[model samples]
Target chain A: AQSVAQPEDQVNVAEGNPLTVKCTYSVSGNPYLFWYVQYPNRGLQFLLKYITGDNLVKGSYGFEAEFNKSQTSFHLKKPSALVSDSALYFCALIKAAGNKLTFGGGTRVLVKP
Target chain B: DVKVTQSSRYLVKRTGEKVFLECVQDMDHENMFWYRQDPGLGLRLIYFSYDVKMKEKGDIPEGYSVSREKKERFSLILESASTNQTSMYLCASSSHGWSEKLFFGSGTQLSVL
Candidate 1:
């Protein structure tokens, strides 16, 4: 089974500062990794995904992720954080040939102004 | 713009009552999924459908059942509502194959009393 692990329960950063949320995955074959963000009382929004090719994948809202095969990691990054960027983030991986994704326990990000 | 719509944004149901959550997607994607979001648990897939009338059980499928009668509609059924089942339910759809970026509905906040 493919699974994702998010080591941190919460991440705090000041506005305009860079932020990073760590994610690691275990899968049998080539992994398809994804990042999603959820705001309070709202559904998840797709941030980005890493399938193949480039190591640095970019997504919505100035967010990006780096896929590291050696580390089995896909860490989300933003050069500058906004208070509006604060939300619960999740990392997911889809096992090869499976139709379902296994998600991490999620990390809450809080940006302070 | 593609859209996934849940039948209700908020629902309050009594114990022992049959609960039904409906999801519809306009994108005509080949896959649909139902998931529950709880604090510290992220999103656990309850059920997913890759084709109409084809369903697969997910991680947490004990207390839930799902139906996909049409390509664009999927429904989650709770035989008996329980307090522990109270959580934010999300519906998502994605195209088949690799690089599938899921599109999610606004979610339904369900409360069982």
Candidate 2:
């Protein structure tokens, strides 16, 4: 079955510093990877996705993700973290058959000033 | 903007009672999904529907059933609510493309006693 792994349960970053949330996925054939963010008591919002083409994909809120086929990773990154950037991040992958999305265990990012 | 609306934001039910979670999408999306969110575990897909009346079981669909009588509406039903089933339920919708991003509504926090 297609699955995703989020290695870090929590990441503490000082404000204005760079932040990285790690993700890896297991799937047959080329994977359709995605990143999502959820605030407290809210549903998830789409961050970005890696379907094809360039390795680096940029999305809303100045966030970007790098897709590395060799490493089997799609890590979410932000150049400078802010207090508002703190939230729960999730990595997901669509199975090759294209029916559903399998999500990882989630990473919580805490940006403190 | 694409809008997915879940009928309830919070629910409390007794064990052995039937529970219903309703969702509707305004963009007329071809696909709708139901997912449960817990603390450590990310989003676990319970059911998904590709089109009207074409539903498919997801990774964790054992105790849940779905109804998609209209293209814009999708409902998740729990025949016998249990304590273990209490969690945050999220509804999402997207186009038919596998790589398309999903738009989510505010989740329903269901508590079964």
Candidate 3:
């Protein structure tokens, strides 16, 4: 079974400060990881995905995520936070090809201006 | 840009009412998924269709059904809406590949009274 976990229920950061939302995963085989963001009353929007290759993947809205196999983590990050960047973040895992994604419980991010 | 569109942004229905949620994708993607989002519980997949007329149950599929008569469109049906069924329903689509990423619609907030 593939599962994803987001340790934090909420993360608060000041605008212009760096932000990180933690995620972890468990899978039977190699994992395909993804991060998505959801705004108020809106659907989730794709942030980035880690299939293979580099540990660090940059994505939309100046956000990025680092995949650490040893730690079994894929934490979403941003060099500097913006008030507009506040949203709900989710991490997901897929065990193998053609498998459905298993999503984390979600972490709500609040970037204060 | 890939685009997933849901028919309704918000809806209100009484308990025991039959509910229909429609989704369409303009990207010609081969996979479409239905998920419901709730506070704390996150996004739980209900059903997915990899091709026309082909549907698969996801993590949570009870009391819900889906239809995909056309490749670009997918519909989710609640046999009988209950108070617990009220949620933010999201529609998503992705290409037919292992590493493909998902694009999502704005979501439909269904309130069951």
Best by TM-score: 2
Candidates 1 and 2, the one with greater DockQ: 2
For candidate 3, the lDDT comes to 0.92
Best by DockQ: 2
- Candidate 3 lDDT by residue in tens digits, B1-113: 88899999999999999999999999899999999888887788999999999999999999999999999999999999999998899999999975678899999999999
Model 3 CAPRI quality: medium
Question: How high is the lDDT of residue A87 in model 2?
Answer: 95
- Local lDDT at A72 for model 3: 97
Computed on alpha carbons, the lDDT of every model, listed in order, comes to 0.93, 0.94, 0.92
With candidate 1 superimposed using the best TM-score fit, by how many Å does residue B28's alpha carbon deviate from the native?
A: 1.1
RMSD of each: 1.2, 0.9, 1.1
Interface RMSD of each: 1.4, 1.2, 1.3
Cα displacement (angstroms), candidate 1, residue B113, comes to 1.9
TM-score of chain B only, all predictions? 0.97, 0.99, 0.97
> Lowest summed lDDT over 10 consecutive residues: which window, candidate 3 chain A?
A93-102
How high is the lDDT of residue A54 in model 1? 98
The residue-by-residue lDDT of candidate 1 on B1-113, one tens digit each, is 78999999999999989999999999889999999988888899999999999999999998899999899999999999999999999999988864688899999999999
Superposed on the true chain A, the predicted chain A of model 2 yields a TM-score of 0.97
Task: Give per-residue CA lDDT, model 1, range A1-113, as digits (tens).
Answer: 77899999999999999999999999898888999999987789899998889999999999999999999999999999999999999999986566678889999999999
